[model samples]
Target: MTIFHKLVSRFLISPEKKNEIGFCTDLDDILRDDGKVTLKIDGNKITLDLSNLHERRYAACLSTSLRYPQYDIDNLLMAKFVRKGDRILDGGANIGLTALHFLHFGASFVECVEALPWLAERIREIDDIRISVTEAALSKRSDGFVDIAISKTHNQGSTYDSSVIAKFSHIFGDDIKFLTTPTITIDSLTSGPFDIWKLDVEGAEIDVVNGALQSLKDCPPRVIFTEFWDERVHKFASVVSASHPVAYRAGITKDNYQLELLDMKTFEKNSEVFFPISPTYVFLREDCKEI
Candidate 1:
């Protein structure tokens, strides 16, 4: 670190010693206002900017030049389903990273559905012509208010913070606040024979899919990618079967999902760990054979 950078770090830490212990101060100037950071992914460069008041969880991962834990997995899934002029549905698009990837790769249009207003605001900052950003939660009901949970780490979006459950009386705790926003069922909100659908709504993956049953049945997108965790895997699997039984007819077993590992260059290789305990799952429609 340069002397000037070190001095700045020292100054920021001196004020709140306890809170600033592990915080990075070298980039504080660049982060002066919460915003986007331009990054290079698999040799392709893109910019990510978000609301200044909200902290971006993926910022650290992107800024440190660390590969996104699920980037490889997502890429593999995208490779199978994405084609030129294909439409993609990106649920829980936090900061538009995944949407950016699809748009950059040649998807005709991407509809990003984000529940958090702040995060959606950040996505709107992108002047890209190929992507459409929507600020609404996908729910079973077409119109109603739902609890938009929030976590300490990523104040903009809701997250499951099991560790802090005991300390805080509520799941969201005082640090987070809930706002009633417009909600829509996936089918009602979008009219699509969309080529690909990606869902990553924390633990609410099933609920979001449940609301999109009609669309899934009608279009049966070539591929579906969602973040499934150990705790909710069974529920997610059940929802997949019930909602799109024909599309997932091979059965809900682990093998049917076909998880492939990815490298920095976006190359695919087989691995045991397909989903990071807190990772993303990419599912290919049974009818669409992989090339």
Candidate 2:
């Protein structure tokens, strides 16, 4: 590290104390020698790993507002759908930030599924009794393992689909690494009842949905929050239509965090411009009230 960075890291006010001051020091500037930063959020001490440039960048963005990109949507879900002691399933839970938030929002139990072993270890470090950590990729296969293509430079965008890796090669760069991780379908991992599920499995959303079909039928969740890319929306819509009858595109910008009920026909009609505006989606059963 540069001398300036070292000085900043040593002298800057600690992130855990940021709330008292109404703002946070940029995490990249205040990264510690241990490669972690502890921030107090909503009365809980949350520590994040910034050992890599990718996470450092992500932390820098989150430090500004003390929240992640999906903060608003999660708040909306809690306010509208979640009840006290609701069970949560956090798919692609990177380091358990959202899981912590779910606990803060009154979740009785949370199951976190993360593909990367290192990231899963970070989540396990929290050691919260209400949270359980699983270190495996959620894929179509219930038992075998799956290959993940992880970017050496930026690990957050790693996925089992090589096509997704190639599509975003410029962002991930040429420094890619491959590894095989154990797989568990959502249907198998979640045997009991669950209320809310937040899924963000990169480009493998369809795989997760496919694996959870039986569970979706037997034990339907109150809400399902996920992201949809234009390329994969059709198949995802087709597959999820059986269980979730209501769909809405969640607007993520600062000024517009509202949920717009989507008309599939209209969305497809304007797919050229509409699909790219917001990838966030909320799916609910017919009996559930729209949020």
Candidate 3:
């Protein structure tokens, strides 16, 4: 741990937690193929779960996700607009890494809601029938129940709302771990229509975009990869000024980890060039273009 302390903690970390997480797995093919770390996606495989650590970015974010697998470039630009059969809607499906990158970029379907019913049975132990995980959690009210506030040494997130996970004061309130669950509204957890909407849900992404405002006005997701925190940036500018269209605020390009979108007025007049703890946005709606 000392190539000069990993180049001074890689110049004091940033580049969106190093390559904007969500695409990694290789570090000598997962510690020389032993304590589990395999990954193939779309073509299957999966594995992972290197027996948890007290939490050091979950073991340096899975060995910096296999030693900087192109630093995840915002989930590789949301897996280049996932097309194959597309139907993603993985709002906070943590242990499922954006539903295994929209089922390895062919989507075909993916529900993975997740409120930690044991990480939705550990994402159905990765069996994948186009995934369905779903432990329940959506917002803008749906019936009731919604406590959440997990953090177990931070980075693994979850928030129902306590003013949106109370700015993570190291996982606030008795260092988080409450739970409760049961909240529906994304059109009552969908009965139809879906075409990409991988919201990370750290700060409730504005109560799941205010309970999916009538399912984004009757199914309107061509893209909506959520998250742009500055204490939720006014709940992502009040759900992108009421239901969508705020493309590009994406980040992670401190020097080569590609992707740097930014346009909403130069990303709200430069918030120190993003990477301020949750900067992933790719909204696109107004007569869309590029997923």
Candidate 4:
């Protein structure tokens, strides 16, 4: 091949489709040798470590778009429920992106709960007074710790769920590492009056609810955005029924970014129809269901 053709083939385009990602020319400006990227979003700077193999996809997006990728449903939920001066608990925060989004959407304060120590430290390094980081896995217990399964490829896919671990083991085969992380109950974290909560603790949403029964009763949040699965749907809803009477499966419309709310009753009857899709849900207080 000629010199120009060789340069185009090697740097501009690749024959292998898998290698096409994370190959922007300006990548060196943001991505460092250690795989850290200092991304500027809407004038706020967030430095993230995207060294993990699975994290490169995010790095590629951050470098190109200058936005932290988030689920449209989450953006919709936050836009609708997160009122000004709202206090939010961002449980299972991965590098505090969603928490930053919460702040951007006008929340006065966001308490981020993360399982991995390193990830929590990254959030703290942001130095934003509106955001605080707590390093602990949410569980039914206030003391002791839990063993979480961390995947070598997908750091954000860490979980303490047995079913998830089994499935990941079968699929990835020895790429998962077990780490014992500190545990804390949702009730023990604060004294209440939080306006909103975003919980994405894999399949442990029920345990978090169980651990926060007291807080849920005394100082119930107006809205809760969480993840739920087919097997634990009913139990998960039942646990928080007293505080949050109405539940809806949240998602963006197939055509556009419109918000779609499916009633829990309807979702429960036909969950298989939405399987492998977004399992995120919104539980609302009776008075707040109109939103």
List TM-score per model, in order.
0.66, 0.77, 0.31, 0.79
Cα lDDT, all candidates:
0.58, 0.70, 0.63, 0.73
Residue range 1-291, candidate 2, lDDT tens digits: 544245444444566774332212344455543467666555556665566654554444444433333344566556666779999989999878778878877888989999899889878877788889988998887778988887665547778876778777775667666789988888898534689888888888889888888889888888888876655866776787777878766543433334344566665554444223436777888888555
Clashing pairs in 3: 19-71
> In terms of TM-score, how similar is model 3 to the real structure?
0.31
Q: Which scores higher on lDDT, 2 or 4?
A: 4
Tens digits of per-residue lDDT, candidate 1, 1-291, equal 533333334444445454533333244454434445556544545554434332322444444432333344465456655788889888888877788778767798888888888878767766566778888887777777776656554443373334323333354656765566677778886546578888777666667777877777776677777654344655665566633332221111134335443321232132342333344454555555443
Q: Clashing residue pairs in candidate 2, if any?
A: none
- TM-score-superior candidate, 2 or 4: 4
- Stretches of candidate 3 off by over 4 Å are 1-48, 51-113, 120-135, 139-141, 144-181, 185-198, 201-239, 243-245, 249-255, 262-291
Query: What are the C-alpha RMSDs, in order, of all predicted structures?
Result: 9.4, 5.8, 18.0, 6.7
lDDT of 3 at 267: 66
Q: Give the candidates in order of TM-score, highest first.
A: 4, 2, 1, 3
Residue 33 displacement (Å), model 2: 11
